[model samples]
Target: MWLLNGQSTWVNGYFYPGENIWAQCDLDCHDVDLVLYDRNGRWVAEDTLLDDLPIVQAPYEGSFAVQVIMAGCRHPRGCAVVVDSDYGF
Candidate 1:
């Protein structure tokens, strides 16, 4: 996992045949949604988990192409994201 500004995220380790991920903003608060775009640029996830945070998680058997937004009506003040990996380096 990696962080910028005050948010954290991670990229997919192994992608499926056709999978993608992304992070979007809901400055209007009209909808609560988080989606992972596929390799074809298609939003994949079905819910919004990063509405209050900038962290995105892949599917049960997938990874993610996370994002961090800097400007918005409801942005993060301070945050933390945790990713587990045993590839000790």
Candidate 2:
């Protein structure tokens, strides 16, 4: 969590198309951002606001990877976050 300014960690899963998926971390990981990529490593959707909650809509049915990046970490111990993700139509 407390690494380079652009450190990224990814979590992968299979999701159906035409649904909204979202991910969020703890308060301490507020500066972190979420990026959604398809199985082919194609960008689909992303939520990069001041808020920690990120949401994306899947354009196709396939396995996707959610990239969590530490845009900025103020905590001395870094930004260790527990991400909970789910999909819904």
Candidate 3:
């Protein structure tokens, strides 16, 4: 089993208006959960059982942070994660 964790360094809520933003996470898990939130401590989005090129798109044009947790009947030995951001359309 493996674990890979990463996130956007930009501060949420500091993003300019009308900014297009997106985040992509790569992971392999028997069972995994992904979550996103604003700097103000608001739940933005979440997903469960993410595997094989899982990606999440921001609903609004703003800054936010992402959190991912992996767990299941059998623990993951190893994994890899990468995060990137882009401007809003």
RMSD of each: 8.2, 3.2, 5.8
RMSD of 1: 8.2
**Which digits, one per residue and each the tens of the lDDT, describe model 2 over residues 9-55?**
88887777766666555555566677889888988888777666666
Candidate 1 per-residue C-alpha lDDT over 1-89 given as tens digits, one digit per residue, 9 for 90 to 100: 22233333434444443333333433333222333554555565544443533333444444444333322233334223333223311
Q: How many steric clashes between backbone atoms does each model show?
A: 7, 0, 9
The TM-score obtained by model 2 is 0.73
Q: Against the unseen true structure, what C-alpha lDDT does each candidate score? A: 0.37, 0.68, 0.46
Choose 1 or 3, whichever is better by lDDT.
3
RMSD of 3: 5.8
- Model 2 ranges off by over 4 Å: 1-5, 87-89
Candidate 1 C-alpha error for residue 65, in Å = 2.9
Q: On a 0 to 100 scale, what is the lDDT of residue 12 in model 2?
A: 80
- Would you list the rank order by lDDT, best first? 2, 3, 1
* Model 2 weakest 10-residue run by lDDT: 80-89
